[model samples]
Target: MSDEHPEPDGRTRHYGDFYGLSEPAGEGDVTLVIGNCQAESLRIFLDGGGLRTVRTPPIHELVEADLPHLQRWLARTRLLVAQPIRDGYHGMPLGTAELAAVLPGGGRLVRVPVIRFAGLYPAHVIVRPPSDPSLVPPLVEYHDIRTIAEAAGQPLAEDALTPDLVRRVAELSLSELRRREVANDTVVASDLFAAPSFDQMRTLNHPGNPVFAALAARVRERAGVPAFTVDPGRPVLVSVHAPRERAVLDAWSLDGEPTDHWVVGGAPIDSEEVRRAHLAWYAAHPDAVAAALARHADTLRLWRAITG
Candidate 1:
């Protein structure tokens, strides 16, 4: 929103400037939210008076080259809200621990968990091609886990997409998510599984607004800030939405409209089109497919169990 519209190279790098508000009353009132894709929504919810909230490019997207931009923004941050990032991440000093080290005395750093729940779309995953890890995949990163399973020559049974199997996958998804989020600190949106207000997620990683609003309230509690007041009126993370299969809804007893098609940038996409494209891509690049299979091997084993 601050004229840094396009992420440097097409990745969601430059993001989260709300209400055209950039400057704060004091330098100590600056806050920066850093993490993966969900960080943008958190940044927007954290928007209001007092703190000049700015969100850096998603931490996973930042490279050694983007250090200057990250550092420039970090220098102005007094209240840094970040997910758990390890030091030397991406061969640079851009981790949450790394960034927190640069904060001045009395500056605050609030830890926010990276919220992800697969109860909504258990088959979807975000994978990086082994060839060019930076290339934004078609449809903006929603890949069916079954694609990688097939690429690895691991096929599922014809009847494996059952409600029972979906429920097990959802359980495994929750276990892995809690393992990652709880070990850090408070888990944001952990209660979203049966939340009455929202469906929890449009995809595995992209959460609905209520999840973010809850996270903002957590950040405010830790940062000693006033209540968040800026409401975007529309969904903030609406660029790409995964399908709401009937199986997933019944698996979690979720309440929402169901569509087998994906909604990308407000446009519907046939799931078959996505499957064909991904299969073709894998066929063209066998080596990359192998790498992805190997990387997701452990997860695949769990998925395999659910299928068989």
Candidate 2:
């Protein structure tokens, strides 16, 4: 849903550059960046460099809602910059190329590479806080996970505490900070989590990160469009813990359907008794687990070869 403003009834609010408020562009002049929350940072960067950019809603929203304003924006877009459509688990209805094919002007489409860092916190952590009593804090004095852990009287191990983890927590902390920064009396739920705090992290792309600017420049150069340019500054270095061969196999056995996050084929333990039996069996026959791991490694090697 769009906000009620002085502009036309159906137009979505243009958000970037100037804080507090933004005005819509003249007809057919907007640059539409097709992405999610990360696109906001790109919008900010583009606006700062003198480009009128607006982020399309998450892929799910666009495909489901079919909002009038969105259609209008798409029709009028001068340039379409896109990242892979990722909203939760479901695949996107269409990508930038397919979407551009339908737009009236057939705008220039620039696809950018998305560099994902292993967030200290998982996606589920944001959607659902830990259910374990030991993890939940009595009071959320600070929104950072480390602070919460300390508050819960279970400080994280030194090895577990990392810059990536801290930054990931900081990303959420920025959201929490915004929650407090805004006036509580008149704050709307949309505004509460709408824009990300650029202080801790610049863009979902991690603005200062090397990848953000590289992609932006590629869009500008390939599109042959003139826009002001500025240094993206330094990258915020953080450790990445993405799913890889070694890590994946170590955590799971080669056994059911392999989802992005889970290895379903492992030994089935439908009940507590089954689980206990499996554990006992593993203890007695440790080589079985090792053999399963070897199979997982083989699977990964084949995957890498095929994909690469």
CA lDDT of 290 in candidate 1? 72
Give per-residue lDDT, candidate 1, residue 263.
84
Residue runs of model 2 more than 4 Å from their true location after superposition: 1-28, 48-50, 60-63, 86-94, 118-211, 230-308
Q: Each candidate's lDDT (Cα)?
A: 0.70, 0.40
What's the TM-score of every candidate structure?
0.81, 0.41
TM-score of 2: 0.41
Task: Give the TM-score comparing model 1 with the true structure, all chains together.
Answer: 0.81
Estimate, for each residue in 220-283, the C-alpha lDDT of model 2 and write its tens digit.
6666766556464633322211112222222223222322221112332222243344444434
What would the per-residue lDDT of candidate 1 be over residues 1-308, giving only the tens digit for each residue? 45667324333323423222243333337788888888878888887757777656777767776677677667767788888988888888988888988887777888888766766676777667667777544654666777767766776565556566666666777777677777877545565565322345777777888788777887887778877566779886777788777776666566777786888888998887888787777777676667767765665666667555
Residue 68 displacement in candidate 1 (angstroms): 4.8
* Model 1 weakest lDDT span, ten residues long: 12-21
